[model samples]
Target: MKKIFIVFVGLCLLIQSRAIADEGMWLPSLIHKLNIGEMQKMGLELSADEIYSINNSSLKDAIVALDRGSCTGELISSEGLILTNHHCGFDEIQTHSSVDHDYLQDGFWAKTKEEELPNPGKTVSFLVRVENVTDQIVADLTDEMPFAERNASIQRKSFEIQKEATEDTHYDARVQSLLEGNRYYLFVYETFRDVRLVGAPPKSIGKFGGDTDNWMWPRHTGDFSLFRVYCGPDGKPASYSEDNIPFQPRHHLPISLKGYDKDDFAMVMGYPGSTNRYKSSFGIDYTMNETNEARINARAKKLEIMKRYMGSSQKARIQYASKHARSSNYYKYSIGQNKGLSALQVIEKKKNIEQEFATWANASEERKAKYGKALELIESAYENTQDESAYEYLVETMVRGPEIFYFSYGAKGLYEALKQDNQERVKTNAEQLKTELDDFFKDYNANTDAKVAAALMEVFNNNVTPPYQPRFFNEIKYKYKGDFDAYVQKMFDKTLFAHRAELEEFLNNPKLKTLEKDRAFQSALDIFDLMSVLGSKMRETKADLLTGRRLFVAGMMEMYNDKKFYPDANSTMRLTYGTVGDYIPRDGVHYSYFTTLKGYIEKEIPGDDEFDVPGKLKELYEAKDYGQYADADGTLHTCFTTNNDITGGNSGSPVINGNGELIGVAFDGNWEAMSGDIAFEPELQKCINVDIRFVLWTIDKFAGATNLIDEMTIVK
Candidate 1:
């Protein structure tokens, strides 16, 4: 019976490995080759050409890349009204917020086009076309050529291809590799810089379930925001201007107030950030033991300090909301990922796969010559990098964790100009530095940073070996007698950058000697130098590992000719299809696919930070005025789950139904499948999304933004 059970599990694994109709993150341009028939069979109402067509308007025309590629947004109206996740627009909301007009606490809505708030640096890009350019890029390269020479040849050819693709056009072009550099495609994009915030729900509604409920199932977060794209009078991309008009998009999604049913076909199209689906067991073990451990520990300390300070004052809360959210989101994700990876036994599965691959490789001399040493290379790489734990900890704490380092590092160019004795260069750098410092100091809290620095520095000093310690750390240990708190206090009190006024004045009257004498600047330089050395060491040691993994992936593709192989995500737009579904996470625990407003109200704890229900929303719920957003049973759905594959940058991707109508906005993933990026768990993985009707209800009833609602093409 035990042997039978084992065999059954192996069979299940084999079945799962063959990309199911809904399992792969497929290239949209290759849908015909990989997924069109299956998608049509699964109930796709639109043809492949209707989904993606370079010569004509299609669903692809409506989707836009938010802030380059961090998130995605879909056009809801021809007037360029875009719908995306609230957290995707969190930074912009925070930028427009302040103590007096706290847009983050209270929502903002533009009653008219003139009232829309312009975002300076925010931009969105539309995919113009994708062309197969593999032959062009690697035509001259051979397998026997030196790896470095071959890489250089590919890069040089890619540069020429991108240049030709974008020549005499306003489009931006990039060459993306697929199948571990076995294929390449040139993608052209039209970018618009004039994006404006049209509307957003208050934090009480938009971020209702805060960190406590992030990435959890049965979610009730609204998780949606509204923006509009603007362009010049001729409908061409342009910089932000008062004279700019609302962009008339080629196509816009028709949102369906009709919610989905179980096993109903759903599709997601967006730029997913990354995945390591082909990672070896050695890499998995390293991530489990060192990478995740370092991130979890360092972020936990920083988040604790930020929360303490944020809890004390509303101003602090406003200033740190974006920062805190960014830190805590991944802190919790890292924790969940470690748990999921262990619970799913991913490393053990990887080892089994590796063993199978080894056996396959040894069956023939040609296979042995190509793939025999791959696993050894991977194992040697991880084993030789045991010190990466300490290195990563230092990076998290001293380099990235502390804002002081960032501020000082931002002025390195200015320091170099001063050293060069070039007055013109110094003057130019001074203005740039001043502008940068103004932006930095706006959201920065000195007291909070000082506390964080002291805590994180102590953690670094206590854990890192002497040789791995940064110079500033050693000074704290030997000179200050391990009194990190004292060192931090003194540094914060004396650093010119700590006082914006003093920093501005110093920028105005720049001096090389005075700058060099600045302790904070000196500390930043030393830490950056050490980080450079450590990064170089890591790159050098991991070179063979990278090559080996690439070869291994290609070898697997060759060996499994019957199975479809999709490349891991690299922040390129792709499509994933699945269904609205439920799952049993564990025995006797069948989770539902949807959550309603009633569950939301039940989860509310009045006066609690994470689960506070807005008074207006509560009143609307109490009065049973869900408008057109409620079902026949009078319950308004807040969120739902689908099996569509997603990752970090896929946030705000439109969850379209069979008829190519928007039903929800994809936001989070289930905690049970946090390991999906490393190894997809078919039964457990689910994409959590805010129902479109809930989003519309929030805009129409709770916020009374009828003008904004009037702009959308609601398919009721």
Candidate 2:
């Protein structure tokens, strides 16, 4: 039977490559050919060219990729500051918050460098190299072509290898696709764009347990933040100037304050973003019945109409505090990833690894014509969950639940330049929608999006299926007869895209019958023509589910050719490593890896708004004051835990150690591995960091800010 299923997949790949040493995320330019000799026998005192070098300055230039990969920052000094996580600069501290500079309820310190703030479309990037171009993108493909002609010949040889690796560099490049497209790399980067901010703390100390301790654990939140970057006078990137400067980094992360013990080691490097550890089980039963049940039923009625307009004040809580923490961080991460994929059965362990790859592809006929219909073409392209459950309930109720149907679908490019009459392309798309109506009416509130468009149009007309509704739910069931709050209060009282001076006086006289008699631009053109007919019927079963997931990840990499695989997270820049232990998550329940400031004053509740507590962090925890950033058991620790393998763009990632320094920032994961981005529960995953001495004891003793503590290089 194909040599007894290749010696039962080489004894299940030698017991999953020796029970994963804190599983992989790797690729720091293949850590000197696959993890510097098992990270130098698990201690790794640097060297993989000092952690990735394209000819110098290493630790991948102090890891960045914030807005680009959506979170992860480090560069701890040589002036470009950085440090990341306070919910990844929670929308630039809720865009420099207001009720007279609230900085998300009191917090913000710049102390100089002209009291920092500027963050116009923030960016950070870095990376600068990584090659692999998988044999020049599968050298003119085959296996009889077509999967949209081998994805347009791997997107025209990845746009000619990212235009010859960024011709005449201002560097950006791309490529990506690893292991599902069976490898390819490139990367490049640089970015910058004046990022600013500088410091933050008071969402009760960077969001202390709000959303009742997000992704739980012994976490005490001080979830970091701070920023810097700048640049200009020939250093490079520019934009928000005033004659910029600070950008002097090629490697920064120093700050250790000598700490870390339980199995020490550790490591991280950032930009994690996505992970689908080889998906399947019909894509985790269509990601738990259609995209985490339509983002936990349209973000639980748009977070109860944005917590009733952010409790009707503090300027609607700084205009929906970063849109209610980005829709309650994935509506409680799809209710804890559908209770950790039904408590980790993980769709019966991906249906017993697709029934041991369909019994070793029907025991040969040349592996049954090269992997027989890869799990019957991924179970006939996920056996119809009716157009992927009405395209994930029209992308969680009208393309990411109300904000007036994608801001009146950005006036369909000024209604296709006023139906091609094109007066200079309708004055350049009406001066880019009047310069995006001053950052969309500065965090819009049209009555809290008209009660989130009448509670997500009654959760998409009682859960989709009227042939995927959206003819504005048959004009709200025949002209408001079904009311939906009087058809969303007469589509927000006759939408000139919900008044910002009547959409800048109808974009200074725009017409086409007043945008075809607007009602939020004809319900944003019937919600983008039913999202272009359900994205042309899911790109007709997405080219046979991308040729059965690139021939089932190339027949499980030629049936585990001596194991060693990695590649899933796609935001990119990887490196994982592990240690600072702690995890028992079950039976006798032992949890602690770290957390103190006396468990953030034993999770205080004085006047609770998710466990409040900040009378100057309860007067520096009743004066023990933790000066040299404590922790020799003297206390003040805050957060920690590791066994590394992170996700969600390794939120503010840093947690270094083995003499690489920095030691903690990674923000949240535990809750018994919220399906660790599709399975990698090495004993209930972990990551959850914060404690770099509770981020320098909240910038030197709760915001004394001591000129941002003498521009930090602090290793002591």
Best by TM-score: 1
Candidate 2 lDDT tens digits, 301-335: 89888987888888887888888888898889878
Per-residue error at 612 for model 1, in Å? 1.2
**What lDDT score goes with residue 627 in model 2?**
87
Candidate 1 per-residue lDDT over residues 1-716, each given as its tens digit? 56434422432222123245567788788887777888888889899989999888999999989988899999999899999999999999999998898998888888888989999989999999899999898789876776678888989999999999999999999998876677899989999999999999998888988998899988999998999999999999999999899999889999898788999999999999888887888898888878888888888999999999899888889889999999988889989999999998888877877777788899999999988887887788887764687778878787779789878878888899989888899999889987787579888988889898898887777677888877777788789998989998998877887789888889889999877878788888988887787887887766678768877877777776676778788888889998999999989999999999999999989988888888988899999899989965678999999999899999999999999999999999999999988887788899999999999999999988898878788887
Question: What is candidate 1's local distance difference test score?
Answer: 0.86
Off by over 4 Å in 1: 1-19
TM-score of model number 2: 0.35
Q: Specify the highest-lDDT model's number.
A: 1
